[model samples]
Target: MVQLDLIELADLVRPEQLVAEILRQNPQMPVPVPLEDLARLAGISKIEAFTSEGFEGALIANATKSQGAIFYSNRGPRPRQRFTIGHELGHFLLPWHRQAKFQCTAEDITSGGNKDWEIQANQFAAELLIPAPLVKTRLQKLKDPELAHIMALRDEFETSMEMTARRVVELSEYACAVIFSKDNVVRYPVWSPYFTHRLCVKKGERLPAKSPSREAASDPDEWHELDAHWWLVERRGEDTPESVYEQTLVQENGHKVTLLTYDPE
Candidate 1:
């Protein structure tokens, strides 16, 4: 194993660059990237379970010591725990991450705040778990971006469907978006760069009346064609309407994920 000082490893600003460098160093690194092993290799002395409430995980260190322990909530699901470990590792490795000790909440790990460090850490975790190159190859081979495909990716990658879906949108060539909602209220949406349409609904807004997400309560995992305007804010004076493919999946946790793909035809 190559000895990488914090400063040497932390120069990269982008998560992709960091992940690429990590993989470059450990060319034999396997899929599902053994985060705990990487943590240990990167100066983490131990990964222990914590019974703390509110916080998902934290990094323990001081100015004097480069190595530290990682603590994660024992109650979180295994997948979430893995993500938390990766998130804390990012905080440890990134030179720009100034906090010697970090206590991250669920939202900090998931929704990622406006703070640069939090966003970078979240990106690092996501890329480390589901490397963009692998995800891009998988997306290219898929005939259709269905809920089942996302679920399969989740299982194969040992990650949450939400994370897998977000990765799909981030790397896919198709114009697509994944909207997550709880109790019919939009929580957040991730969109592919090629997706030109702007989502009309904002966070905390109810699912549009005409949206297939509205039918998720009755018929989950169903796909339907919707008028683009139903989801996307229309361009002023534009008369032509495009068709958007919509699929809704109701998670066991009661969160609804609606996958939207624009017609490429």
Candidate 2:
């Protein structure tokens, strides 16, 4: 792995800028970026498992944030641990994430909500590990956006479904959204910038019974169509698309992912 010079990258403030600079410098950086090495070069002294209660990950750094060590839980798959390291590294690299210690829960690792710092850190981590340009290039090659395509890319990127799904939603030209659930309860929703309507399903709400994600069927991978109103809460002046395309991939331990798409028109 080619080492990055933090000094050369110090001027970048936003997560996108910092990630772009990193890729630019290491133009040959391989797919599924060598995150651990990148973290070390960025001054993370160590990345080790921490089994402490209530925290999935933590970062402890010196007063000026020159150096630090990341302790992430061993609870989930390796992909999640890698993401945690990337997330904490975001805390270390971004000048404004100045806390001497950071303790992150699974929710923090998963969704940052309106907390700008948490949001930024998660942004940094996703971009660092998955690299948006790579994702876009791959999307361009796919004939259509679907759960199957994202699933293949997820394995190729060696990332969790949440990371891969959100990245696709962020960059896909198709108007679309991704919902992540555990045991059929909506954990969060991520929609592309082009998707304008609000999904009726809020976080923690049970997915509508008619939704493909809630159905037990012979082919979970098949795309199903439903009235857009089933999933969307329409605004006062608009008509929700007559039908939206839905596909689901049930994951390990009842974790489920569903993708919704429609014509950009």
Among all candidates shown, the one with the greatest lDDT: 2
What tens-digit string does per-residue lDDT give for candidate 1 at 55-174?
998999777447889999999788898889989988887777877899999889986877788888888999898888777778889965777788888888888878999888878787
TM-score for model 2?
Answer: 0.87
Worst 10 residues of 1 by lDDT: 1-10
TM-score, candidate 1, is 0.88
For candidate 2, write residues 1-265 as lDDT tens digits.
Answer: 7679888778888999999999998988787789988888888888899787698889999998888999999888988988888899998898888798998888888887567888899999999889988888899999578888888888888898788988898898878999989888998999988888889999999988888788654255688889888998878878778888899888777888889988655
Candidate 1 wrong stretches, greater than 4 Å: 1-10, 62-65, 216-221, 236-241
**lDDT per model, in order?**
0.81, 0.86
Q: Estimate each model's TM-score.
A: 0.88, 0.87
How large is the C-alpha RMSD of every model relative to the true structure? 2.7, 2.6
lDDT of 2 at 157: 83
